[model samples]
Target: MQRVLMAAGISEDVVSQRPSNRQHRLVNKTLRRLEKLHEACADPRLGLKSSSPYLLELLPETASALRRVWEPYRGLGAFTGPAPGEDEAVFLGLHARTLLAQTDRALLLFKEAKEKMFDETSSYRKDLTKLSLLFSHMLWELKAIFPGDRYHGNTYNLTKTEARDFWKMTFGNKCLVRWSIFAEKLRCVHPFQEGLESVALKATLDLTCNDHVSVFEFDIFTRLFQPWGSLLRNWTQLAVTHPGYMAFLTYDQALSRLGRHPRKPGSYIFRLSCTRMGQWAIGHVTSEGDIVQTILENTPLYLALLQGHSQGRYLYPDGQDANPDLSALHRPDHKAKVKVTQEQYELYGKVGSSFRLCKICTQEEKDTRIEPCGHLVCRRCLDSWLQKSAGHTCPYCRCDVEDTEPVEVEPYQPKHKQEKESDTDDDHEDIELVVKQMASLRKKAPERKTAQQ
Candidate 1:
């Protein structure tokens, strides 16, 4: 109950929850010492050398205290282990105290605006921006306490082809990125650091095909939530629904107004799906739950829709242009289908006899063939080659074949009784040839030796 009140802006003196004696003393000492440290650090006259000498005397004791306080606060275990004793009480109490203090400061600024009759002469816009920044921070910190730990590919490195695929999925086609502003800054810490190591994760989204990139970043001290779609939706909802917020701040002109704004405060709901092949990393944020749920609900189907539409198959294509040529590319298909003569095929076929083994597939088979330019490829290797090698020409001879198709092969029979006729033919040929040759050479043959009994 005291913790709740404290969170609700009650004073520490008014907190009825009694903490353990040791913890109470520890909290008071730490807070007081921390205040002193801040004070000393801020003093302009104190040089680093002088300050360090003074601080060194207290370092060992301070370090011990800091370690004691930090044990629970450093990890997920911070959420558990006991009832509201002094350490927990002080720690939780500080969060509310800080927010309440900031809220009061914001309210003071807001009151000043009202007193000035909402006039342009007042520093109200500046004050409002400050208030927004503070409120954003407060909300940010509250959410950070138990951040979603799901990883998304955004936090890690990617292969070029994989990146291209991701880019195509994220931004290409008829779908454009919805304009956004008033982004929440969030962060995640790299756990292992050597001596004040601060490795921070940067978040960004690339809207490809559309050719755009957006970025969001925060200090590594705060743990971050991943897939931030829901968080983004919630944050956007809060910013947008705060009626006339942008207008009041004189920032409406600066923000992107891509479409109609929502009038009420609520979650921006959507269905998402992500690919199974996508990589994931640690310390990602999700607005409400695991990122897998967001991916399952939003990404897959959205990508499929984007892909389908990009392929020129829309629900209502009747009013659209009949030609499927991409206006942006400016290249027409008329040049792709020039006719070639049968004599060219015959000439190539004759020259193709010397070819063996595919150049690309590199299979050591004699089943290779060539085109008019004498480029060689085995029949089995053409399909994959055609799929990826766009603006097609034969890899080996650079032949401009009008049309190429996959070669079909018949099934082979097993070596059984079906081979009897082939064996008989071979025997008949060998017998006659050998007998005639032996007769011709009979006069020159050596006599066989008698066997010893």
Candidate 2:
């Protein structure tokens, strides 16, 4: 269960002398690093691949001082969620507050983190300086543990640009999911310094929102938290209604079998999702001769998916019809399974383009920038739009346009005359049509339009 660190001077302290604040933080940083090394060694699923090039590297000097925590679980079982409860969080906050468990301290800390760190009006959302402050607040001793600590006296901290970009990415889309993804990414960026997962549950309070008391409040999460081992112990104990379920089949194992047998396209079997434990996923052979899988958290039985969705998905390895016996057990509520990214690829050609065309018609040069939503529209087209609607609307995001700005093009001071000639062309029928449309719109006194409503 433990590995003894053998060092001549590193004897256990006889005196109960309290460590200084800086020493405590430094030791915590070291302990965090050691924790990562131990997990890397224990989990073969990781393939010992360092998330960062600098992380998971062992130094001969620290070998004698490093201790290994016993980890018996591997593969699917390895994910024993860090802060599964108040106990785990209490264990983590021990060094600072020895009586953390005796009181409601763990709950308070988690509540504080949820409110101060991840709340909608959090200071990290304000600006870079505040975000950097958060970096220091936690066990993030970035400089001492990363590139800066050893190399050319370098001070490697996050830049304003990186800080701003991180905020946009993590808070840009869905609420909880973005933060979860952000936490995952933050782990890699600073992996060598200290681990993030051990502290993530505390940070996210096991993915609890600020207003909510527990994540178990959500039913989908209830199913998600219960690992597959609890549902059916082994293949022999399979109680799943979906006949396609080849119980406990790993993705690699399924892929190998399908490759060897060479089943027809759309042949699929329901298996435990590799990405999320306890979740049902389809390991199906696609028309493109590839085996693909995606975990659907909400739906337990993929029978509805089998019965309804074509998605090039057929039940069993032989592409046979669904067994009436299995279909009778649990009736599917939804018409069909929700489409995943790969499933949508067959229908959608391209997602989006790099060219900043007007999102309304998707055919004009974006000349006027709408404020708040930051959507761009051609000025003449926008004038007619404002006249008709009598209310400002950003056709792109559907946000009520508050203000407008003319998109200024910096004068192209090209070094070569040939470059200017090469850039300008007469072949743009699309651009000319847009230009004609811009000219035709009756010139309403050129003034900035402001729409509060």
Candidate 3:
């Protein structure tokens, strides 16, 4: 059925007739040219592709037609959309310290991004649109690894029956059978509202990677350092609960699966350990650097270019170059590494002012009280009630607050700034710095502080 569909759509001439090596070469060259166009759009360092007719010829008519639409604005460089910059590094650091672990970083990032970019009155249409595109690209990369006859776009809606059919046809193994069934059922009965498919898609993509990597591994990295948001939460949760048979991981895992690993000292046999599951899944991302090195060394174009250029024959001993070794320069490790662009950082401050409380606070607690009527209160105000209160009255309004029913409140786990508040004026300064720094990183405002009444 798939073959029939392909033949009908691609045409009999293109499907059955295999291209000669020369033809294949031409196609590869064209793909490289297309890549140049993409590269040009991403970074200004690469000169424009318009100068060379050969490069111009490489782009398919369809892509070429859309070239103007894809072009970045003057002075804007290529529109890789908003990314974090050095100024926003403080917030990034705060995130590494705060919600990176035990929470959805991407959602946090997205919320911060949305807050930074848009506002309560501003719909997230633009942010979601870009995010949807990014997610589609990620899915495309995953699909490339696991070839399928039909690719439903990120928006492909599958009925429960169709999803079941998809799984049965794609993966008939017993272990995966249950997963497929569950996924199909989940599709029919999803957790979130009908809207926000794009948001859900991004989260699903991230969650798919997380499941393969294991939630723990991803969480650890995000918690301590990375400062992305969890824009991909609902979809990710859905994917986690009802993932496709194929597991996804970081780009590093894909490289490892392709049989590339770092060469240990004096060991002819490359290490191949037992396939074990980590916090995300039973996959590997530990040796992406080696795979990248191998691809660069083995590729003919790389060698030819090395000879063609001023640089002599060189070997990559370990793949830790701050800059890219190849022309495309989209390194797997670099792409995987989370760094905020300047736009993202500046925008964080703009958006951070929108939310009344930071997104992290929302996940744990938010709007549990109203001011006067049920005035705003943070963990500090509630701490006193921890000792004695079936229901504590609002400190501001003195209204009979019935919901103050404390249930053996756990000891307060001071956030990153709290522990540091004890040191000195410097320490207090540090806490303030951390709070101000987090302003950019957060989508919502920090919980307001108040004395216990």
Candidate 4:
């Protein structure tokens, strides 16, 4: 109950709960030391050390004049958005405690405006674009992704072809990147980081597609979630010799081009499908040296499945070079491998299952895919996150999640059920033997008094 209250911000730990005996003394001592630590700190060492001075070194009159500029916006939060706990944490650092008191005042003012003047209130505002602010030597950037925020307008949006080029050039052919199915049209990165880990699970979404924000199981260690900066790794050079995606070519043209190359059984070429924007047609030579073609879906997993069942081992234009050449997951050092021992399989399954669990609640599977970002999270968690967020942003990635769609995650099958049953039988036998031995031992043992003395 106390923990619940503390989490809800209704009560403090010291007020709702107390340590007994010596533990109480430790708590009081810790508080006293903390107070002393603050008291002994000098004014210069008090807050963040700015690299440069204030941008506006204004006189008293000038400051008042600046305040007057915002007078008209006083009813609309002075043209400000809701506070994100994080922006202040980065801007003021430890000094943000004083800013906390100001938040209540701000909330009260917003409420008073709503009550007194309904028509003038900010509550009815919609389609509010995500705003970013910059100040003096220290910059305060706010990324409060609300329901109607416009990331598509202010971000690096991409078309289907560009996104395809992105993949063919990088780890595009790899199974590890099957998660980037939604980063096609709109762009904005929500980096989820903890500790000093350089690689954070960054989520990107096409905000134009989805109508809501999203959340990801950021703590999941799957390779699918990588630093957004990884997208810049130059892999477009592969297309030069590979000739994988030959744009502006018809089926006959692709076939004509492949005919000129060496008559390798597995050699193939891909041309943009005339029907749709992101679709492609794969023209490949059969084992019998006859040409065959099929439409390729705009999904990495589908392409991977096709490759797995292909007559040729290598990618198009390079038979025997193999699709593995473009896959980082098949590398010797990669955690995910094609083959493993039975023990390794079970161990990986166990670990993978845990990783797939929703880190937010730690009780459900992250089986629902949030649109635009394509982040998998539980419905229960996503709904709860949406309710509490003043402006709906993902708790993990902090992305502007617009909508969610339910998805099917393959259930993990552990190979230890039979072994567990045998172990249980052994445990039962051991328990029976222990009980008999204890009975015999008790008959030969001396009695003892039950009194405290």
lDDT of 4 by residue, 1-453 (tens): 344333222223222222123323333333343333223222232231221111122112222332332233233322233232321111111112212222223334434554332331243211000100011100111111111222111222222222323433542222111123222212233232243221111211211111111211111111111211222221122222234545345445556666754567667766434332223466777767777777532223223434544634234453434443445422223111112234433533433434355656768966555434455567788778787888666565677654333344443345643443211101011223334545655664544332333
For model 2, name the residue pairs that clash: none
Q: lDDT tens string, model 1, 312-408?
A: 3321111222222222211222111111223322332343421123334545432322222323345446545555676446554445432221111
Misplaced by over 4 Å in model 1 are 1-87, 111-123, 129-453
For candidate 4, the TM-score is 0.26
* Candidate 1: 10-residue stretch with minimal lDDT: 215-224
Location of the lowest summed lDDT over 10 successive residues in candidate 4:
128-137
Better of 1 and 4 by lDDT: 4
Q: How many clashes in each structure?
A: 13, 0, 44, 10
TM-scores of all predicted structures: 0.21, 0.27, 0.19, 0.26
Query: How would you encode candidate 3's per-residue C-alpha lDDT over 267-344 as one tens digit per residue?
Result: 011111112111122121122323321111111222223332334212321222221233432122211111223333
| lDDT of every predicted structure (CA atoms) | 0.29, 0.35, 0.28, 0.33
Residue 223 local lDDT, model 2: 40
Candidate 2 lDDT over residue span 402-425, tens digit each: 444344222233243344433111
Q: Give residue 38's lDDT in candidate 3 (0 to 100).
A: 38
Greater-lDDT candidate between 2 and 3: 2
Decide which is better by lDDT, 1 or 2.
Answer: 2
